[model samples]
Target: MYPEPVWTEWEDPDDFAEAFQLHVERHGENVYRLHKAITAQGFKIDPQTLYTWKRGDKEPRSATGLRVLKAIERRYRLPDGYFSSKLAHSGRMITGGGLEKLSVVERRRLAWHLPDNFDLLPRAKRAEILAWVRTVIISGATDYRRYHANAVLHRFSFRFSEGASPLPFPKPRPLEERLADEGAPEVGRPVQTERAPIILDTEARDLRLFKTATLTTGGRGRNGVWNDETANQKMEHLGLLFGALAACPEGEVRGYGAPVRCMTFAVLLFPAVWDWYLRWREIKRGFFTRWESEMLTVVAGLTRQGTGWLRQSPHLAGYLRPIAGLITPADIVAATEDWDGVCETIHRHAIVRAKEVDRVARVHRDPFEPILTILEADSPLGEYRKISEEVRRRRPDRRRFPVAAAEATRGYLMIRMGLHLGLRQKNLRQLLVVPRGRSPTPERQLEALKRGELRWSDRDGGWEVFVPAVAFKNAGSTFFRKSPLRLILPDLSGLYDEIDVWLRLDRKALLKTQPDPRTFFVKTVKNKSNSGAYEQHKFYEAWRSIIQRYGIYNPYTGRGAIEGLLPHGPHNVRDVLATHVLKQTGSYEQASYAIQDTPDTIAEHYGRFLPQDKAALVAQVLNQVWGS
Candidate 1:
């Protein structure tokens, strides 16, 4: 059966008011004029109604109401997606576009066209022109009608060529007159002037008007003067020009919108510009470098005359007194040398400090005897036997049941297997206890135990457990390809018999509920939810509690909890496996291959042996090896 679609309309005056206020504030005075213009154009609504609609005071009455809303949208020159119901669903308000609509290709073409006619205007006028250009570019206006207004304004305000010749203004002239103009002498054509001649004062004074205007616009004459507004205007002009250049195809601007977009543009473009300037030192006969160096020298002179370092600091710039000493070439060289030395010294100090920090942070706080020492202990296994015997002695009384007896037994067996196999936690979690071959009852416990496979090859015709890489951390790498671990047992048949008895006695109930017959780890009476497994944290806790209750402490360090247990919640079991493997093999390469630790790291950290007593370790390993 088909269901009917449902829709709901929403209205909120306060939200609308707030949204409108924010829009006005961000777009500035022009927004108010736009609002007035829209109202005066004679829509059947009052200005207040329009305001209320914009503020969310009223929902659009119908689809026709949406057309009115679209009119307001056009006035603000909003982005394509603005005012759509999608904004309502997404909980965002409509606002004027901060010029993010342009495509990458369009922006590149705009940038290429800019440098040709950029220089011949007053700072404020230049800023206005660039701002309009930015708007046109962002609006994606490729057609003449869409961008013609801005282009006309820009051409009217600035000379398009070096001779101060005006740009050609489009007019309704006759075709015959235009053709006659095209036949004029070529000698009067405007020349393209490079920056070098102007900088060197080789060109006539009138030809240097653009550079002179820049300085004057910033309120600094040949003798220097204070004009705050001029400085601001010049800065605004430079920002616009740089921003436009950065938007060009060659520039590396990223992202969209104001502030962050501008910052992204600067982050990408500035490095490229700096790199090019550096390289130009060789190719351009050092002209660019010399000019930059001279500019820096002038700045340094101004900074040093009265302020010194305090005056030169960015924080105190406006507060500093003017100075007059010129920075010499020797001074520049010396400063560079000092900076390099300081940086080198700081880097060396950082390395030393990091080592000191690491030494202090490496505190391991476990309260258990090391497993090796416990295994080596003269009567470690005997202690367990004694405890079991005592519990048996008091078995007539149910209250005398051994505390954590099941957990202690299970944890001891699991840890022994982990130490032997170096299996990671994920693989251990998914391990099952199923019979090998055609036996009705399970024989051997296999890993990577996929369904229906009684046995599979382990690479070299040896019996092994296959483990998949997805169970490993670096599963994507080809280095640790799906491999098998040899199932080498001292008495394989006897081991299988013991496992069969354990499963029959301990996990019979849990096995009944599972639909799949191939699963290995059956739920036991001790773990009620026994759908074949426990969480990693629960397993760690069980191990920790058992070790603590047993009072097992390492003989060498006198610590009791697992060797490297940390409160990183769980997952240290994997590390324990890795550490034990490394200790046994005495070869990082072997340990890495067995435990999935990178061979490179193993070589770096555990490659060499420390001066520890061999006697205590060998005895402990032997005792623990047989689970005595």
Candidate 2:
């Protein structure tokens, strides 16, 4: 029997078996010698009982076998209750979820190279290959043989820490589901994750694809420059999308987050299913011809016409269908036909789950109150009151080419634009200070804004910034909007003065070398000829910098350098907008239009009143009840 605290907390016999397997290592397939070695450790269990325990068929209910199991755990060098964590006290990892989270490349390396009990192996020696996956886009690795999968994994650094994905990974659970012997069940509280998966400096890795695109097409390939540019960006977004899918947790549609198996399986098997369909139809072969044939037949038989797919397997076709190709949208309602009404249920749950985990940790319950107070100080053109004037000042440095002051002013302007406009991150980032038709130097752009009139060729004389349809995320979806979005900036009196000073002094310093840039927000590059116009990531970085300055941007999980920084990211700024608008106007539709979100979405996420607001209303009603 096992000693105390080793496998004592285990709820499932199978769990104990897996943990035991961790100790059964390098027996070199010698069962008799392995059993003898385990028995020598002071617990005497015959091979027969050990086999049953390994198979999880026979549970040691009585105290009779505890010492033997503990012997196996200690012999294997596993920590106490290595696989079973009922009270959530142990630190040893017993589940495959962490391994599963590694990209497709890492999973293959672990599965193919590592032993069954590799967790027991010297920790450093495992992972014979360095990287899991080298490529960003989903490769043809799902094909039958997974040709060159190892080669791909070997080329890149596939670090499998929680930081690999941008979205939050699901909380860890025991390998086998367990029910306590007594009292109410414990659904465990949310634990702070070790590292945030989302990385802000994603552009460095992501932008490489665009460089390749430019080299391949010279300008735009056959599709034209703009069209090709859009397509390339879509390819870049897939890495993050896969990470989001990876982040989904597992469990019931009602109480728990999306299941990990349910999530990864949904994507992993998606392309595999298509390959499966092709092999069945004799269009393409997988792994090898014969293995592919047998695997296909087994899968087809499982979904055989009369056997009832839902009855035999619990896998939801709806979830799989959406992700299967990753080429187009999945049919949600169709996926649920056999899902026992769980497809819609889980989909909805995933949405809500995604939102909660994605929220910034430091965001105040009333995010707007802090922002409003900051905005009210009448310092849009000046430095924040909290910081000393010596550190950062509103006054523009009149020095020739004042780089520091210029960049600071630009950052200040960008943050104010985000708050005042209540614009979505994407929209806010794409804003044009100078119309595309005009040469957009800092001076020219500032002149345009201060001119007090719309100066673009496409519109009237007032200050209206028009965003093209192609720029919208929902441009293809008819339900969301009619594009060619128009934004009217509210007339904050000192706005022109801020822009004018930035143009004449601060921004003017940066723009001294490069002239005739097209975008208002220009990055300072050493190159005199290039203004580094349209440097997209700066807008995001600027928003985050100002938020950090306020000391309000808190990440739920920790991250490294600026590249690893998630810091609620720019999207949460929209949440701030929604809450503020809803609080002031009490109109979901108005708030939605202001933020360019659907009313339903606004209501769903931000409609709930703040506790303070609710208490005030309740107090008011009570006062009325007392006949004021």
Candidate 3:
């Protein structure tokens, strides 16, 4: 016996364990008594399970686990969510909730989003519910999204491992020898055409030096070094270039079948090599795309005289191995002996080739294709807000699905911030948060880190976002004039309340016990991944996921915010903002201010102010005479 209960006033428990223990003690009962009472009430829960729950060793995860907590609440004469609300959002898959019909992977993903009474529902009803969740939430059923899902599976680009320096990869067996050993492919099956390029020791070093170094060892004739992101893009681009060069012509890639051993960086110095590669790309793609133009631009920079990487690094010539038609043995000798003259010749050829590629470079994929519904609207920003509304409408139950609820809240704020700030993806994901009543991070520190901060502003009486000029990709643009970006976030549409709730509860739920990355938006912490920070690809996926789940309409299930909406990323928000202003004001200057860009940039890239939109604006003003 627990010695007749004394009147002890306990502080509110911060968690399920504390709450459970406090209630049991206040009632002057032990776990055995509590278990017996629950059993008497027709609920069979393990005595040890009660002990574990009391001890904070485990709380509840599955529906059964939750039911046991409900029974305990009833025994204690507490509210339905008394103990349940205090449980941590473990983010682990919640099973044993009538998901037996689902595949193991499906069960893992759908468990958190399922209703509490999901198991009790009829078999046909469960199937209907699952179909909706799978289509709208998991698959993001949209035309473009479906296409993207399939497209990513057929990866043709090379992936350089992180921290991969210019060093020799393991020597690959000759293609013919390896193929013979594996035997011939079946008639119907697709043949493996492109093997990862086997880079030599010299070529790898040159590749490294070209991308990472600020200046060549000699420190002459170069434009600039590539940033990490740019460097990665270049590596991927170059990988595709090399992969196409090495792929078998007979196979699907329809590539040149150049010897893997001879595919050195030196091949880039030859005019004929560039010509062959350029022509092969055009043939493969069936039209000129920006890819060809971008690749040519990279080549021109690499081979440009006085500062070109290939020109400055003469030793690359020594590594050149002849590819029968592309590079003759004599050409290699000539290039090695007269590196400067050969570079000068190739540099001129590259410049001429780049101009030719640009003339025919068709826009392969329209940037606006995904969000045409939003962008084509008279009020694009107004139309875009439907996504946030949809997110709020479809938000899950917080007590039962804390992590999912937090994720929904985060998605809402992500769209809100993107609309208000129009900051690039890097600037947005890296933006830090300092809650109300806390001292803001110093501007100098933000500039040093090249990130922005969202903080409470007592003077402005609203939330303020401050990012240094140096944080922007276009820091030197005349729009900034070296001034930092400062904007007071409008406290509208429950924006302030949402931010406060996120900081107080939702954000922490997503982080769990993981170390806070200090960023406003965080990835849901799981066992496999502990960090709460958003990487580039993960961040892009997060934005796209939000759009997929809420933005695109599905006629079959009758969910989503907009009809004909496709999956797009954070960058598309800038287009939305710019176009919105352009439609209203008909001034590129005002439109530029919306996204912090120059009028020329808005005219050329951002704003989609069609001739009709411009004419309509003029007609609206001119028609004022008829109204009078």
Candidate 4:
């Protein structure tokens, strides 16, 4: 039997060099003898290489390095993966073995999944491994995933410069001048199509004013100010609208070739323009969608009677000019004289248009498609927990891979906390964090800010969450009744330990020197531009990324937890919670409590408990009588 080597201070070796040296000492072997033994076994290794490993100069990473380690392990009579497991704890990814042929991105992605002896494998075997990894792990082969992949390839949107001023409309050029301009150049220059028009300074200023007016409180006849999220949504919606208008009919967007230079806020005054845009959307998508309906609603808000910014700004009508097919000079003159009447007409038209679009609107994307596997389960909550488990299992060594470790911890908490709270994305992203010793944020302050907080509850003797009713989207619902939500978090699955680590070390590591947004979750701070706050879109992406990495099981790699799982955002957690409650209690009211919603809402939207599922539940109790 190989005897354990006595250390000077009795500290166990962790790095490869110390461990290798200790094993060598235990076997009464030196570097020369190990080198000779390895060479004799048809594995070529230098004596100096063993010396370097002993001196802790470098640890094994490549296939050859692994082979040498295995030979040393064999010489010492140690268990398989003994040295490699120790190397894993070193924090550097074991790569560069069979991955020489792959790109930098591919190597990084495949490093965790690939075996140490990957390079020693046959060419055919390597190809098979690469193919499987790419298909299952790198590129998910789901039908909707395929659709998304293909959809992003065609970029149709245009970006407008905010600084550019409106140029004077060019008069018709003489026929000879036009012909001469049209003539091909003699040089090797590439021919270019007509460029998209730059947004004028006036046009940019109008948009800024419109957004400001909408966001400002208590404007004349104004209903309410838009929140930050709503304001952003409007900005994006209008950007797409104008981008489509400027797009060429012959191009990928296949839009009506309205001259962007001639188009201004005045275009919103004409009913013909809105109708054309609606029809274009319908034709492009091959059916009416909720997008068109929502867009119509936005237009209605923009041109509403007394409160409408466009209704008040009659001067914008003068900026309108004639386009070849879309607009006429006569339309501009008419709009300038009766801007308020034009606004009233467009406002009414939008309302009517919205209803029409809604009647025929088809559901383009199924909200439940990505999470069908989780929802169809008897215990959806239990099924979804597998993702959190996968994250915990794959958590990198904190000592070696601090950033990756922090990210893994963050991902794990995101899944765990989401399942527990069943809160919407906005609430989850904006949930403030207060450390255990710190005073919890007051209920009044939280209500004023329309946000929530996670803090230690000294009275309850556990971690607690307090969310003001006003912070919720459904604050007026019967569920709240003006009462705030308060829950003491049970310390399940080492939750407290993980949370402590996150608050003390991982959170600080992720934030670095960046100004903390004080949210429970923080983005991995890589640069000055990264504010460490989770915006709506970025937060959704982070959740989806977690699902992609840990939730979706790859049969080839055997890494992820769940089978048949697709990438999903945090919102799907509500469906899982609702469906789980419904299955267990067979009470819609009870299910609604899980998601802080109403029974009717759960039945209509969240819970997918069909008639057959209900019948099966009843049948289970009835069948027990016969068995007895």
Among the numbered candidates, top TM-score falls to: 4
Model 2 regions more than 4 Å off: 1-396, 435-462, 476-483, 504-506, 527-531, 549-568, 605-608, 615-628
Q: What is candidate 4's lDDT per residue for 1-628, written digit by digit as tens?
A: 2334443343556566678887777666788877787888798777788798788766676667787887777666677777876663322344544566667776766765565666667878877877766665555556556656764555444444332223433243343332233222122222222333433335544444445453542254554455556665665566667666666667566666565555466677677778888888888667888988998887788788777666666666645666555556566556767778878888999999999999999887677877888888888899999999988877866875788899999999999899889999999999999998999888899988999999998998999999999899888899999999998888999999999999999998999999989999999887655699888989998998788778877664456888887777899999999999988889899999988989999998899897888998899889999999
- lDDT head-to-head 1 vs 4, winner: 4
| Preferred candidate (TM-score higher): 2 or 4 | 4
lDDT of each: 0.35, 0.40, 0.76, 0.74
Order of the predicted models by lDDT, top scorer first: 3, 4, 2, 1
User: Residue 78 CA error for candidate 4 (Å)?
Assistant: 9.1
lDDT of 1 at 50: 57
lDDT of 1: 0.35
Taking all chains together, each candidate's TM-score versus the true structure is 0.30, 0.37, 0.74, 0.80
Better of 1 and 3 by lDDT: 3
For candidate 3, write residues 1-628 as lDDT tens digits: 1234445576886666788899898988888887887788677678898898888777677677777777777766677677755666533454554666668886766664455546667878777877876765666556545655664554444444445345543444443343233222122323242434445434544565556675555456567766566677777777777666665666665666666656667788888878888888778656777778778778778777666777777766545666767777668768868988888787778778778888878866677877788888989999999999988876765775777899999999999999999999999999999989999999899988889999999999999999999888788899999999999999889999999999999989988899988999999888888589999999999998888667877553345799877767899999999999999999999999988889999998889989999999999999999999
After superposition on all C-alphas, the RMSD of every candidate to the true structure, in Å, is 32.5, 27.1, 8.9, 6.4
Q: Rank order by TM-score, top first?
A: 4, 3, 2, 1
Model 4 TM: 0.80
Q: Which ten residues in a row have the lowest lDDT in candidate 4?
A: 182-191
- Residue 191 in candidate 4, Cα distance off native in Å: 16
